[model samples]
Target chain A: MAVEVQYYVLLSMALFSIGLFGILTRRNALLFLMSVELMLNAANINLIAFAFYHGNLTGQVFALFTMALAAAEVAIGLGILLVLYRNFRDVDVTVPTTMRW
Target chain B: MIYEQIAFALFAFITLASALGVVLLREPWHSALMLGVALLSIAVHFVMQAAEFVAMMQVLVYVGGGLILITFAVMLTEREDATDDTETNADEVVQT
Candidate 1:
């Protein structure tokens, strides 16, 4: 049997769950960032796959916008991480409450 | 039937493996590098699905812009300590 669109969707979901797990469990600040990227990529894959399956340009366009937003997010996030590291001399995110909330 | 299935399986494996590597690796820098590889592979997969524009944008925006920003973030954050790492692991960073 040939591979189907649903297979891709399932893979995307599985990858998304793994990324979520990483985000929930990992303590390293950078690894946490990568996990967030992984989740975003999972959503992108689903969008693009559906775009292909449906023969439309919408999903792809959405993915492009998503990529743009992700870029902006990382830029701001990195700036904050830089300052946080400087203030605390560490990047562990557990102490965020003492600093912010 | 079998050959097509094999190819599809290979592509799936490559994608899943790299995605997993992004989380599994110990070093933050290596994880970012692997994430780039995963994004590039995803771009190729998009091409396979006949999404030429998405594929190109994936390369240009994701690999070019996103990955570069991530690497720069890693470089700017100077957390040299390997121990005492604990995190909240919540607060999913989302725009909007």
Candidate 2:
């Protein structure tokens, strides 16, 4: 009746892969940010799942820190995204070619 | 016991599907909504795993704050005419 930890691990892996694929294929900067968040969520899921499996609170505590970090990341990332849109007039990831060598 | 398995399957399916929708949707607003759904489902999963505090935090931070931030970004960055033109172009590519 109890859910196996493997199932949770597999679920997180699938989510992480989807996020990675989006990062690689999506041209929209906002989509990239969303993908990154998805990846982070996957990591958090793993942390908590392992914590539960091991009967310890370390993983959950780490997950809490991860959430705080995610919050800060969203704040900084959105600010950068807003600036990028203003400067380039588009949120397309391919627009910023100036840095390309 | 059986019910727990069923709930787990349901939550996992919803979470994965909406996560896919988040990345694959053309409209940013739609993607944002899907992301919200995915996060909510993950919160449900957290509850299933007995991490009640994490589940609440997931709802508060992700569903509440993160979603609003994404929605605002989508609104602020939207240029209606430009988006329409781009949408048509994307449709053409998809058709081909």
Which one wins on DockQ? 2
As for candidate 1, its interface RMSD to one decimal place is 5.5
* Candidate 1, residue B78: lDDT: 49
User: Which model scores highest in lDDT?
Assistant: 2
Q: Individual DockQ of the candidates?
A: 0.45, 0.47
| Pairs with steric clashes in candidate 2 | none
lDDT of 2 by residue, B53-80 (tens): 9999999998899879988889888855
- DockQ result, candidate 1: 0.45
> Best candidate per TM-score, number?
2
Tens-digit lDDT track of model 2 for A1-101: 58999999999999999999889878777888889889999999999999999999999999989988998888888998899889977777666777989
Which CAPRI category fits model 1? acceptable
Model 1 ranges off by over 4 Å: A99-101, B1-4, B83-96
Model 1 clash count equals 0
What tens-digit string does per-residue lDDT give for candidate 1 at B37-84?
Answer: 888877867776777887898899888987887888778774565563
